[model samples]
Target chain A: MRFSALRVFREALTGHKGWTPTWRDPDPQPSYDIIIVGGGGHGLAAAYYLAKEFRRARIAVLERGWIGGGNVGRNTTIIRSNYLLDGNQPFYEFSMKLWEGLEQDFNYNAMVSQRGILNLFHTDAQRDAYTRRGNAMILHGADAELLDREQVRAMYPFLNFDHARFPIKGGLLQRRGGTARHDAVAWGYARGADEHGVDIIQNCAVTGFRIRNGRVLGVETTRGYIGALKVGIAVAGNSSTVMAMAGLRLPIESHVLQAFVTEGLKPVIDGVMTFGAGHFYVSQSDKGGLVFGGDIDGYNSYAQRGNLPVIEDVAEGGMALMPMIGRARLLRTWGGIMDMSMDGSPFIDRTPVEGLYFNGGWCYGGFKATPASGYCFAHLIARDEPHPTAVAYRLDRFRRGAMIDEKGQGAQPNLH
Target chain B: MLIPHPILGLRDAQEFTYLGDAALIDRPDGLANPEAFHDYLYLRDNPAGIHRELWFHEQGDRSWIVVTRNTVTHEILGAVLAQDVARARGRSR
Candidate 1:
């Protein structure tokens, strides 16, 4: 049912029993024309675009658990297109555009807040680097502004600007970049896809793939043997394990990255802010909690929990940047597994296996890339061609030495 | 987490720096087989269970060691020096 002000008023006047389930809890069909593994934000968005844009029929999204149980619900919720490389900048910019129109298109309240994002610099070299990055962002048709130290100070006076060692020098601001309600994004996409007749099957774990000769035929699941003419794998951290079922190994490693939220307080942070000297980035949520996170746990792990050393390191970084945050009691913390690729970029290309496709290796950027990742993945799956902006995210780029190493960290997933 | 250092008893995980899979130690001859080198550099058997990984004791003895740990449960099974493993693999120079 379409929700509106009139509908809400009518429902409020009545017993408010007009509300129904947002998305249907459908059982898996005997087969589908296309099946997408892992019903996270990306997979749901892919299914949405496949049905709505590509007008494809008989689409199914299989999830081990319920929707939004994965990285979509586990991210810091920040979104931006301020990337340095050509292979990444345009694609993320497209995603930013998608985010701007997402709520209205999906008819859901996703809370796409474009309050802006600032990357603070600490030194002259850092300023120069940010200047270059800002130019790269502008070149990609995304908004960017170089703010002086006084401007940053005016924006966030609570920041430790007078730190003797790493004083705040300047910052690069993206006026259109900010956070979104992450779970709402997943729900909105799932509902939109369901409206378009896509089956979202939850509590169904894919055990293995049925491959014959050199092509994939179907999948073996806990539910039963489900047949599919085409299959696309969008599992983020489990990309290696799932693709291994198809006898394929990836240049990806799973690492746990942790995030924290402090107790509710009056609104303080206006926009997302990142520390140049460290990996800490924080933003104030609508509910007044300060959500922040830092570097990964720096180890290979499939577990969704992190150790203490990284927690201490993140807290130290937070203290170094904003001493006022020390008074805030940390309410809760959680970890999400990252599919760190060798070159630190994602892939939206076909695999060597016929009738099987892959869309993963998102590292720390998957949350921001949700819209474009799904849209481009759907385009590739339907047209059998790479999206123009995602042409560089090929699986063989590492072997060809055409790596898109955003940080220039070569072949190291942990460093990426 | 604590890594039972082969020579220094149990050591806090903070003393060591992680370098990922132990398969990295087997450096392929790029000149002889570039394809093998490509696979060695980019691909991985990223298992969810037991994983033998490389870690450097940068804060302790500056020694490289391999730690057999479960990636799923974060359980450390064993640890050994990288030099000893390399020698056992018949790398003598």
Candidate 2:
């Protein structure tokens, strides 16, 4: 393959390109207007909105790992808004809206592809539930289409429509939905916030919080103590651990979910296919890799390595749905820790402490919900009020019997 | 390839060769072949996997199967229903 002169000329200057971070040094400022722990998608996004929306200049984002190295980089890169709950539907739609203009807002290509996502229905109950969900979304200005058997077969001919055990009845398609480059999402937010003069400190872990008179004053990090006027905890999986440092207990439980990918192949399947019956989903990535994942480890352990049972279960589901893909070689498998809540929703509100706030308990949908999570979190941080859509998701909603109760069964598969 | 108790609803039974004990024999022998290894089987010589002593659904339904087979090499030498094996008599009947 031959390229233009610009490509050849740029290749010659690759040696002089050096490693540089987006935001580096800052003054010896002892305090910030608001300090956000965990420089992930949610943290960086909150910082960006804090500067852009509220004009809060004294903001900082502390990260223990490199940007995009956490669960944001580990997810399957899906973006959708079709949900089953009142609390989740509107919030995810906001995130979906933010996703559409994300590339333009950050001036970085995040590959936000609106390829659509379909939730497969095997039983009548699931079909009915998803149909209602579709109607609800449509009522709320979300784009959706109910696809029947003929429609499903016409769209994805590779599906095992002839199978008897778990037949494909139909699906609810959210057309204004798709995937984005997860790493680009983090980098986009990082760059945008850095450009806004927000100091993003990496490789800095929040070890402890110094509290006095029922208020958080500063945090003790691995490097040194960085004092703050206010603190926000955006640690999704490590929410409970960080809350403990402030002498507070959050309504959070940790669960582990695994994602699998296959060896690259020519683009055969289009859009995202979700199997709600068997708890599985798959999508052909832009690079030809098939990204898929399912339910979390039912029990608790911080083990990132998934077990054989889940692997077998997910493979069986994939074969049951797309039998022809049985020959596709599996490339790798990975897992991420999820801070599951009893209600299967997220918490974005003030903590019991005066100066602390938490944005966590996102279930398995946290990756796709990053934008809305950050927006709501920043709203509560700036105005000292919870985002209207996240009003039902309180810290004590579980005990108050006001749980969002998505899927309508009450207890969760892992959190219960 | 065969279980004389019942064929359930998945496959067609080819043969039921009885060894010395109550176990239905399915190995690299005169009766068994390599044709039935797609859906799932508890037979002895499946190329990808051979689940020995697997408790499959019989009489149209069944319970959870608690059996053992080779982990490294999927070789199922023998398998019987756990409940049946718990009350199973001594050697080959």
Model 1: per-residue Cα lDDT over A106-204, one tens digit each: 999999999999999999999999999999999999999999999998999989998999999989999999999999999999999999999999999
The C-alpha TM-scores of every prediction are: 0.99, 0.78
Q: Write the per-residue lDDT of candidate 2 for residues A377-407, one digit (tens) a residue.
A: 8889998898877787688665455778776
Candidate 1 clashes between residue pairs 3 or more apart in a chain or in different chains: none
Best by DockQ: 1
lDDT of 2 at A296: 72
The TM-score obtained by model 1 is 0.99
Candidate 2 off by > 4 Å: A1-21, A25-28, A412-416, B1-93
lDDT of 1 at A270: 86
Q: State each candidate's clash count.
A: 0, 4
